[model samples]
Target: MTAGSRHSVSVAGVVVDDQGRALLIQRRDNGHWEAPGGVLELDEDILTGLRREVEEETGLQVTPTALTGVYKNMPRGIVALVFRCRAEAGSLRESDESSAFRWVTAEEVAKLADEAFAIRVQDALAQHLTAPIRQHDGLRILG
Candidate 1:
């Protein structure tokens, strides 16, 4: 790593329901719809961070079932670990980070979220032998 250059790790969970829909949160900060997650704490493990972030933003307890994808926002130096999760418990509530929530199908996800964020949900829903690694520039996925 170069001096003064560091990468931050974030964890996001795409909570899938029995109806094959993924849960998305409308971020209060930007009003953009995306998965519920945030920067992982230094003291916490991956799953712990995933559960905490999802719960904090959506008020739903989630159990991560698969590691779906790893995405890097090249411009921001943020690497995000995305997971396919099942809602284990709790009711949905709005939080400071999220203003609203929606359970959307794959088609709706594409329309509601940015390309970079929508792909993470799509990857989680697909069946993959291994997690996919991707790069983005905050809004668009890169080649």
Candidate 2:
């Protein structure tokens, strides 16, 4: 690692309902629609971080069912672990970090999010036996 180089780990949850719609959030800071997630705290476990992030953003208690994808923001040095989650409890409410919320299908996800974010939702929907590892530049997939 370079002297000043650092990396952060983040977690995202694709909370899917029985109707096959995934929960998406419009970020308060960026106005970008994406899955509910955030950076992990140093003292928390991955699953805990995932649940906390999802709840904080969407006001839903989520239980991660399976890991869907692992993504890296190549330019920003942020590694994100995306999981397929089930809503356990709580009602949807707008929060400080999330300005809007919606339950969207696959097609809607593509139109709402950039490729980098869309891929995470797609992977969760797919529910493949194995998780995929992908790299992106925070907006688009890397070649």
Candidate 3:
């Protein structure tokens, strides 16, 4: 395949609390509210990258309990693996990647995040029998 045909992989975790709230981070670079995650390094294992990304952005050590969704940003050629995670340790704090953090209910997530990202968290919280596979253009989900 040509370089343009190559897709990058990213990992994200929707850190959920006991009350069923999910964590959202206001990204420092863009100020967009979304789940804590980033592109995976070439040598990194998926779960290790997920844990690193979540902790880097939200300052929380998380244990991924479920694979919630697989999303493709068609325009960007980015394929993201999203997981439902439980916070195992650490405290929430701001970092270079995130400006702020909030624990939001499922409804609040829809309002706070772009449609492309909001769906990821919703799928995680919904606890589907099979993970949803979806496509988007970065902001909106595709049909």
Candidate 4:
């Protein structure tokens, strides 16, 4: 593939509470509610990127427990690895990347996020032994 056609890898973490509610962030740039994540730095490993992204967006340090799902944005050439994470330290506070944050139930996640994003949180909550792979057009699922 050409340099311009290369795909970018991103990591997202779904921080689940004891009540099974997942943490969602309202992105400062887009105002869309979704899991906390961002593009991985060239030198950073997956686990480090996951922890950094979660902390940067939510001000909470997290330990990833399981790989939840993998999603590819076909139109944007972006592949995201979603993980099930548990909060290990820090408190919830708004960061530069996020305007607001909340712990939401599965039903609330569906209402707050688009199908492309909601599925990630739902899959994380389900905790299947094998992660699901999916494709989308950035906002909706695709075949």
Candidate 5:
């Protein structure tokens, strides 16, 4: 959150269900659908950040099973840790940041995310077989 800093850390989830559909949220600010995630706190670890982000955004308790990738929001100069996770408990509820949520498959993620966030969704699907943690720079998906 500082000026001129080129790196910011965040954690996100690629939640899947029994049917293999992934969970996604419609961001309140831009109406773009994306995985549940948020910025990390000053003293928090990745796991804690992941759990808190998913819970706060979707009202779901997610325990990340695998890390899929690391993404850089180039425009904002922020870095994000992406994980393939599951909703261990809690029911889905729309929060201030998200207005809608749904369960979709790998194919459907493309529609929900469209072109802007295609890479993030692709990273999640690729992890379905082998979770590969990545670090890349690109246009901002959440911004």
Candidate 6:
């Protein structure tokens, strides 16, 4: 870590349950419904970070299935790496960073995610589903 360095690389995932529902977290500070994710410590592989983040934020054991999409945010920036994952263990519960967690259907996620973070969930799903790109204007993401 350095004085001006961001010091972290975050890996987030769209986690699915048995019924093909997405897991969403209600962040304590932001109050947004988002897919489970967090930062990568130095030296950690992206998948390791993604799994670790999902576990920490949702208390659910997850396995990374595939890379969905990667977004490079700017300014107060971050390289947001996303993945497709599935929960294989533990029950849903809030952790230190979140107030609540739930498995919401794909349709429900599109509606429930509080505006700002909703785009990421939508983008991740689009990539997971390998849908066609609507624009290459670049996603302006904010947490």
Which candidate comes out best when scored by TM-score?
3
TM-score of each: 0.96, 0.97, 0.98, 0.97, 0.84, 0.77
* Candidate 2 per-residue lDDT over residues 1-143, each given as its tens digit: 88558999999999999999999999999999999999999999999999999999988999999999999999899999999999989999999999998899989999999999999999999888899999999899998
**lDDT tens string, model 1, 51-73?**
99999999999999999999999
RMSD of each: 1.0, 0.9, 0.6, 0.8, 3.5, 4.2
Where does candidate 5 have its weakest 10-residue lDDT segment? 134-143
- What's the C-alpha lDDT at position 132 in model 3? 98
Per-candidate Cα lDDT values, in order, are 0.94, 0.95, 0.96, 0.95, 0.78, 0.70
Encode model 5's per-residue lDDT on 1-143: one tens digit a residue: 55687567888888878777788899999898888888899899889989999998999998888887767766666677888888889999999999999887777877667543556667776665665444344533443
Could you give candidate 3's per-residue lDDT for residues 1-143 as a string of tens digits?
99989999999999999999999999999999999999999999999999999999988999999999999999999999999999999999999999998989889999999999999999999999999999999999999
Question: Model 4: which ten-residue window has the lowest total lDDT?
Answer: 100-109
User: What is the total number of backbone clashes in candidate 4?
Assistant: 0
lDDT of 4: 0.95
Task: Encode model 6's per-residue lDDT on 3-68: one tens digit a residue.
Answer: 676634567888866666677889998787888888788888877778788888888888877676
Error of 3 at 79 (Å): 0.2
Q: Is candidate 3 or candidate 6 better by TM-score?
A: 3
Q: Where does model 1 exceed 4 Å of error?
A: 1-3
- The TM-score measured for candidate 1 stands at 0.96
lDDT of 2 at 119: 92
Model 4: per-residue Cα lDDT over 6-73, one tens digit each: 99999999999999999999999989999999999999999999999999999899999999999999
Model 5 TM-score on a 0 to 1 scale: 0.84
Error of 4 at 90 (Å): 0.3
What would the TM-score be for candidate 2 when compared with the true structure? 0.97
**Best of the candidates, lDDT:** 3
**Model 3, runs deviating above 4 Å:** none
The per-candidate count of clashes, in order, stands at: 0, 0, 0, 0, 1, 0
